[model samples]
Target chain A: MFGIRSDLPLRRDTASRFVVWLVMVLVFMASLAVTVNSYIGVLIDDWNRSVTGTLTVQIPIAAAGDKASAILVNKVLDVLARHPAVAKSEAVPRAKITALLGPWLGNSEAISDLPLPALIDVEMATEGTEAVTAVTASIKAAAPEAVIDDHRVWLNRVMSLAQGFGVVALTIMLLVTGALALTIVFATRASLAEFAQVIDILHVVGAKDGYIAAQFARRALVQGIIGGAAGLALYAPALALVAWLASRVDSEVLPDTALPAAHWLTLAALPLAAGLLAMLTAHITVRRALSAKV
Target chain B: MALGRKKAEEISGDAVGLEAVGLHYDDGPDVLKDVSLSIPQRSFHFLTGPSGAGKTSLLSLMYLAKRPTRGNLKLFGENVTQAKRGRLAAIRRHLGVVFQDFRLLDHMSAFENAALPLRIAGVGEAVVQRNVNELLNWVGLEDCKGAYPAQLSGGQKQRVAIARAVVNRPKLILADEPTGNVDDTIAMRLMQLFVELHKLGASVIIATHNESLVARFPFPRLHLDRGSVSILPPLASSAEFDHDDPRG
Candidate 1:
């Protein structure tokens, strides 16, 4: 802790320091909220971007024609397997498909009797090169009914939308953090001006602006860190509850997904970043205010 | 050179000097003009004048509150006209000021106010504690050390201000009407403290309208009238019939 300028030793009271700490904590929390939301947005965008290049081959047939359809799917898979960019290919077994649709279709007799497609989920190693054009040409000539659902056509647009949304969210968070920093700076400047007489007294007694500003900046930094931590603590449970709620919903049209570890890690980094940002802004503002006075 | 030798003597001198020093508030008429004088090292002096005689204005210049419009101001033998902020701060540490209003930080206690000068100097805690307690006891405000400025009486506040000013043992002490808000007995006692400080090697410059008090102390006088200073011939002990009346 920095020494306050004055010959008169002020009575050390913990109450005032605590109040300052509480205020900083609240500011820190606000910063944390912006950080977590921005990070989550970033994670979703990354996931969306990663999943775009792959395609699935679905062959639907009447119940009587299922055995023949399986043979045709095998022929199409053979052609796809020979492609240079095809990293790995696997056919999603009918039993696994039935289990995936279980919650939506339930265990009803009607759903059990309904015929389903024989689907082959394919993945390509091409990071930059489009493997779909060559693979489609090979598969179509081998099996007439084989449909290569090249996900790129729609995934490109979807991933781009996700990235655009993340950018907008990030922009909003940056703006909010900037506004909070400005508010703290303005408040500190006002406090400094109001105590001009005290400043003059301190100045004549050899108190440097750095000394005084450090006291103010340290207080503001602590307040921001505490605020961010407290807010994050509160937000953690709320976010968990929301994630829990999201997990309880039955999967039908929407895919059943779990948030990645990277998303959680990003969320955790928010509060600390918020605290540092608040401290930096407060430090700069207080130093400027003191310098202006001198 | 003559100038270098003079500068050396000035730096080692116990007091400061003002040469043709004039002050003006941004675009306003001059508040002080053509004031040239040297306060002898370790000497005590009283400034006397009627209302609005620029006593406070003159003091402000000495304390470095407002820069002068024209003239050479020498503090501790250093020419302050082109002094950097760092140099000015170094000189300021050797100076103390007591304002008329007591100008104590409202947020701090009386003890804190006194400890302020020490704290600014970055004195160690144990040393600060010892010095602060001694000064508080000296001012007769040990019991009220924890009390805030608003809670203290006028005389007590003035004593605290004096204690704070002298805490650093500054080379010069500037007091603006140190006894204005107190009674005669308290005022006289306060005057005694200034005398005590002067005896201990700190040159004292007090601005006041209390002529009777000024007469009681046989010090050189600086009289300010119409924005200029006139050094009256130093007063001798009064031979007049003054033994009967303490107020006189």
Candidate 2:
């Protein structure tokens, strides 16, 4: 459908060449922003899925023995077992806790004797923060030094960070869209000026305004398709490289984000949408200009 | 579709009719003043005038290139004085115009230029190729079929223009100085082409200062002077309207 040959010349004009490159650049940037926004959405979803209804209990060493820390963790575990909101609880192994600290402190024998806190993993059968406050109170009563870490504060911080990136991506997309429309309008108008005599000749030869408009619109649509394809082609490897970079980031606070399949479909369709938009823009611009003429 | 029963009945089958038509660019004196004429279907006429006479303007009006500033005009029994652009374009489909400048697109080959009207009419590709090639061959541009306008000589471009104009077999053919750029032999050949088209039911109008062409062809002449027009019968032996003749 995008294969219509342009009655007007395509490759000779500088304005149309600039139009193609501008479309390519704008579509590339817009796709990146849109997909990044999509990725952030997935990350937020993963955060909600992984962290909700789960709590971590940390019993401080207080410069005491690991045995004492274990005793306090057992007390908190007993409290959690009796609590209605807690479906299950298990003390995290000391070796596992030490290994978790392996990032900051090297796995030397001295690091194991550094008196780290005891940890417990808690899974909740109920929803929301109200049950979290009740469990905190019960655990505090059993062992005054024990604390329940619902991770809500950290989750809230991470959620806001993701939302901020989402907002930036959305803004970038909006700006890129505006820039693309204006660029197309500018290029189309330039073409109209350059080919005004051809237009007059066409009209004399019994061509309707729509016929002339179609000649230009078809060229613009083809240019859009070519530029959009090139842009997306560049974007694919860049996105893969981003995914690779993300894979390199090993962190306790952040989960790996994978763009959803639906998002990939949307990105895949961007070039066609750009093509249609260019076609529509050229059509309307020419129609309006012809309307004002004899 | 009709103004009224009587009004529709009053409409004529002339290819073009103008009554008291006046036209001018914005705020300018009328280029065509109080012009009235009727071109009957399948007839031929030569439009003749001195330099600065309104021959080109009258041809433009007849081809619906511009609307008359004031007056009533009709084409093919339809009132089109102030017709919408779409209606005018639809009417223009039946009109074939050969401009003075031979306005072939510089980017298109002579073959492509000849195929323009048919393409506009949505003719299929096979038909477009077949018809355009035939027309180009007949116009003696077969060797220059794929040559662009800039690559062709003036006479070659004029032939391309004429071929493009008549390719669709329009009901009316309007030519403005069509043979101005060619030798007498080629001009006669081109005029023969128009005569053939007229025989095939096309109303032909040629606007030119070529008195010899007017005298050679038996067609009546519509002579324009100072934005007004008068019908003049062919005078095969007279140069009364010839400015350079200077004979009484």
Candidate 3:
């Protein structure tokens, strides 16, 4: 115990600095995960509920004077409405199309300059992809000039991509935690080596191995706890910033759905767990090193 | 020569005894070979040899740091060849060792370092304070009791080491080159302290290269030549002066 107490100052001075840095890094990563994950959760939920039953119809004209295109869109809409599964349909006005294109084509530019296809937004009654596929096939057979898109393919792809990203973020967190553990192990080993002669002297004076090992363990525990707390402290604020930044994104592009609370809780638990793991790793490593000697 | 405990007596009691002991490190040359000697109860002897003559290695064996590759080593009358780790630790609690380098813990203050043996043995705080202070004062280091090892001079650190070694009044005390780093006056004083300990019934073995010390002290000399030990005659005649200090 005295051996451990004697190393308090040196342990605090060096270990605290390392712990602070580790906490900062962990907090940054945790906040980033929470922020990015919340956005992904929102996107997935929106796609599953709102976008899954929706489809779009576009009519492209081969000539400058083609009233047939508009006529064909109306026909497709009528056919879709008669089906029992079809809920509603609307012809997207040219103004809405121009507004959607305003980002790429400046608002000052005339819409007439470009030959834009006339589009009809369609809503179906069912959620499954099979219903949309069957309805699309019927619409295509009736009007060859019309193109039907149910968005299920792209939305599925987007969901898969988002999940993949979440996994990557989680993996990065694991790697960072592992690196921190390795760092703690190395530092503890250095400390043990530095005090090798001291340990020998103590043993000669009838200090048991348990007595010597306790000193190292105690020092590491204090370091681990303090470092872990510091890391968590940094993590909280960074996550708050992420939440703030997420809240400020233009709702027109990224909607203002409340962030997922579970993700934030997971972020909150990270530093504490990492700190404990580091402490345990340091203790075990030190004990093993000492035990291997006389 | 005042052989406090004979080899036969040590065998009958729970005390340390070596018989034809030899030690060699793994994948290294032999460090100790065929060294047979007995240190009886309340006896004082000085080990004399040149540098790298295994004085420290012999002392390490005395402290149970390593086992002999050949021959029997008995501590407290139990054969230590198959001694369990727990039993070894228990035996070590009654032993004290002083290193030439002092080996005081750099992290602890002088007082704490000196009190380590008692602390390891689970002595109470009050007892520790009393004994540690007296030992510190005996070594003339009472004023710097709170100072760290790094803050003290080489000589001061040596004194602290000596104080720590003898603080427990151990059954056995082994000092390897204890006076190597001190002045002559300090060295003699330290030797006198060893003499005082020997008089108090603690067996002591001092290993040094100082032939002058061997000449001055009328004690048995164990000479090491190329990893072997040979006992020499006592420097002082036994009956010259019964009036002179018997331990000295």
Best by DockQ: 2
User: Compared with the true structure, what per-residue lDDT tens digits does model 2 show for residues A98-192?
Assistant: 88888989899998777677788999988888988888888888888777778888889988988999999999888887877788888988888
Q: List TM-score per model, in order.
A: 0.78, 0.85, 0.70
lDDT order of candidates, top first = 2, 3, 1
Residue-wise C-alpha lDDT for candidate 3, range A134-182, written one tens digit per residue: 8888788878768777777787898899899878777776777677777
Off by over 4 Å in 1: A1-54, A58-75, A81-120, A123-133, A140-147, A250-275, B1-14, B82-87, B181-189, B237-248
What residue pairs clash in candidate 2, if any at all?
Answer: none
lDDT of 3 by residue, B1-248 (tens): 11234457554564457888888898688888877776666777888888889988888887888878889887656677667665677778778888888888777899998998888777898999998998888778878999999999888999998898888887788888889888888887888788888878788888988887776777898888889988887676655423344344
lDDT per model vs. reference:
0.72, 0.83, 0.75
i-RMSD of model 2 (Å, 1 decimal): 1.1
**Model 3: which residue pairs collide?**
A23-A231, A27-A235, B5-B40, B14-B76, B15-B76, B15-B77
Q: Between prediction 1 and prediction 2, which has the larger TM-score?
A: 2
List model 1 lDDT by residue over A1-294, tens digit each. 344343322233332344334444443444344444554465555555556557788877734587888787788788778878788778888778887899998876676567888788878777544467777677779876777787666666766666676666666666657766766676666656665666677777777667666666666665666665666677777667765765677643223455557655655665566557766776788677655542
Q: Candidate 1: lDDT of B246?
A: 35
Candidate 2 chain B, which ten residues in sequence have the lowest lDDT sum?
B239-248
Off by over 4 Å in 2: A1-3, A57-76, A91-120, A133-147, A251-254, B1-11, B236-248
Q: Model 2: which docking level applies?
A: medium
Deviation in Å, model 2, residue B166 alpha carbon: 1.1
Best by lDDT: 2
Candidate number achieving the greatest TM-score relative to the actual structure: 2
lDDT of candidate 2 over B99-143, digit per residue (tens): 899989888989989998888788899999998898888778889
